[model samples]
Target: MPEIAPLLGETLTSPTAFHAPLHAPHEEDQWWRSSVIYQVYPRSFRDSNGDGTGDLPGITGELARLAELSIDAVWLSPFYTSPQRDGGYDVADYCDVDPRFGTLDDFDALVGRADELGIRVIVDLVPNHCSSDHALFQSALAAPAGSPERAMFIFRDGRGEDGSIPPNNWQSHFGGPAWTRTAAADGAPGQWYLHLFDSSQPDFDWDNPAVRAEFERVLRFWLDRGVGGFRVDVAHALIKAEGLPDWGGRADGGSTEGFPGWEAPMFGQDEVHAIYRRWRAILAEYDGERILCAEASIDPLPRLTDWVRADEMHQAFNFAYLHHPWNAHALRDVISSSLTAFDAVAAPTTWVLSNHDVVRHTSRFGLTDGTPRGGDGIGHGDPQPDLHTGLARARAASLAMFALPGGIYLYQGEELGLPDHTSMPDDARQDPTFARTGGERIGRDGCRVPLPWRADQPSSGFGGADSTAAPWLPQPEGWAGFARDVQAADPDSTLSLYRTALQLRRDLRLGAGSLSWSRPFEQSDVVAFLNGEVLVVLNMGEFAAPLPPGTVIAASTPGAVEDGLLVPDACVWILSTAG
Candidate 1:
């Protein structure tokens, strides 16, 4: 690690960049090679300015909190300039920080401070699409139809006389056609562009060298600004199939819900590999081991690992656990298939239970529908995970994640056992699921509501020191039991569970090996596996299960694993082979 020269300025670099894996001859402390990254959804982290929305400074304010749990890196989701059509996934500018978040200097300070604390910064990099209001989009709109600036996007000629048109049958991620008629006031009115999510976000034309160059510029813009790596968004979708062929006969209600027709020809196509290689080359110029984590969610591990090979991304998220049903046998199946494939390909992978885009884990499992589930709340008793069973479940799940073969990402509020704040009242919705479909999807707002820092106050502890801004989204009543301050002080709190789980991940080399499930604990609802030294057994159910031999190494239930059986409702047993 670089020694800090408090008086120096120009020679300064993010601590992680200077550390650069050179100190450890074999790059041993190159922790991220296999480690846990704590994901912070900025808006809910802390409100230093008391504006109800979290800012970079708020995140900086919480570094000590994270350090206490021993995380390797922090992957911040888009703090760049954006119209936020998809919650900041659409970029308007690559070089500047959004004022709503904080200043560039604030970011630099955050990076420097984190490096000072030995933490790395892996920022979200949105390259596939740009906001409709982006500068280039504006330039393209004002130019001639065939201008090179206009070629930066996929502007197609008008359709046949009937006008049934698109570059392909691909569907947008948010639902709808992937193509939109380009309506540049000064340019051709009949031209079209492809947008895989909101029509406002036009996909870049990878076939255009200039487009690729601009994205490379975007990548360097941050690495130069002190970012350690990137969380490549929609990485697999960065490039579409060459001819934009349709998935013949695989029908569906639309392309968004994975009914199949559009996913194949449009998502994680083999062609995206070239784009990753292109980006990695630019990253290497900054530092040889520059990390790039792909966000591909497709199956058939080889297809996904295509972007995570030795020369490609250092890691690509393995979303099997997130997409699987919350059951023991089901989880075991996905783990077996995924581990086998990922190991065979020699590509590193990662696991994340919750993220800014997914329904909060609590809600995903039907535990949160604005109903009473336990803990200390107004009408409810305590807002915490007060039940013996719920705590066991949460602990087991977290422990299992830590014992996996690669890095694990911890969602912002998972450490506190916070549930999706679904009871925030109707008119206070902040998610597009409700805006776009009139609540057909019930929106992700429930998971995105205000984060509670305390349980003693009306806001459950997350307002200003003088605190009051109505929060960007309403605070869910479920937070009554999971406030940060309350959990921090409680030895038996979920925060404690998280701290223990994360500590174990860092102290053990569980993140660097291969995971292979053994004997298949099918009937027990346990996803059992081996992560190097320890035998990890996860009971997806509330009841306990039998363990093979070794002494219990680390069980989620503080005391759940006694003789051989685990208590029901999420219990984990980490046993040594000797037992």
Candidate 2:
């Protein structure tokens, strides 16, 4: 294989511009309203240096791949300088890149390459917490209780006589107590600091003016470097309620019938909106309609819309749609609710299925129950999913999702029909959730396996043929069959389906169109919707359904329409022939 040439100092141009021609001149600034953003987990996307981990240079090399899929932008997960305690979410420095992923120069090259391909770049911003090794945190550790450094974080005295007990009963999202007692100058247990996640990641004290001002600087630092925007990680959890009161709610936001909703002390505080309003103002100062997207997991679906108010964030993840079961009625309800809620706020709904944080939808849809597994990821001892069934459902789901009126997010490698490494050995797992839970709850490592680009290459071509180390997470042997090269050659493969769907989506202006349930199948297992002249039909029943009245333009399964009947677990896009 050949090395990817350095994009620096090169004359960048879009020779194969796929999306620019499709967008109307008046719609240039509003591209994100109906765009397709590809989420690239930097560690698993591609490795250019033959190192086990993927780097910015590798992502710069793959800009063409995203352009080929008609993607509007690439949303990169955290590649910030970190201790790697929580997959790089534990940020030690907000302004620079980690050595493992490359330097600030490599990041600039990636932004340039993406610009040349007519695609925007959205980098992850983690403001909720910082790595324990961060200079501020380090200074806090060494400073006295009333020092300025300690004021930058949430530090409080322990409750008990010996100060051994935690200040509160709050729990960590990973597991156990959310507070960790730190040693004083004399080396005895002292002030306890709050951490919503692992101990290595301490939650920031948003109440502090310095913390807010620091994040403002960080935001401008990236925006000035030509990044189009940011995907604010844990967007809603940045500000906690006053006094850090203890409550009966689950720390992870899982349902407890008696717990509070939007007013929860730990998350979804009303004060967080002010932070975003300030960030939005900073974004407005820049050109090219820069954006801010929230990764908030607020409940009731409607509450999540608050983050995307007119002057705040431009988009918020539709997690309700992602977690809904595969049932037609349930899916319809989620779509309806999401559209209604987002429309009220005049914001475009951002649709997504699989991301880096959860189990892949392929495996989730394959389960016998046909519902999300929640946090209990599949392990070797767990019941295996039916891959065939899952892939079919996933393909069908993609067609339906593309035809919806909103922005969409595609997780890397889902286009290749990859499933989770459900049988990965326990000893190889690296996710902090797995270790914090003592292996009782399998972590997201299965879905974060490095992508395979070639069938016959080492590590399936993730680190290239000359790679000196194995991938950070082991790739399953069967993954060779799902390599991009293998699927790109098969017209009926999922990769091909995604390409076709994206092309049609662009040509027909489906993302900007309206969606209305095909009246005939509104109450049935067949989900049929009309997007302008296009009619998308998804058959989720056990038997074939009569094909809707239109000419079939594309289908998830080849020959999906047989004898004028649509097969079960299949989806089709139809061109309406009626006047």
- The per-prediction tally of clashing pairs is 28, 0
Q: List TM-score per model, in order.
A: 0.85, 0.94
Lowest lDDT 10-residue stretch of candidate 2: 9-18
lDDT of 1 by residue, 214-257 (tens): 87887887898778899988777776677777654332222344
Instruction: Compute the lDDT of residue 264 as modeled in candidate 2.
Output: 72
Model 2: per-residue Cα lDDT over 273-297, one tens digit each: 9999999999999999899999988
Q: Candidate 1 — worst ten consecutive residues by lDDT sum?
A: 16-25
- Leading candidate by lDDT: 2
Please give the distance, in angstroms, between residue 508's alpha carbon in candidate 1 and its true position after superposition. Answer: 3.0
lDDT of all predictions, in order shown? 0.67, 0.86
Give the poorly placed runs of model 2, Cα more than 4 Å off: 1-29, 577-579
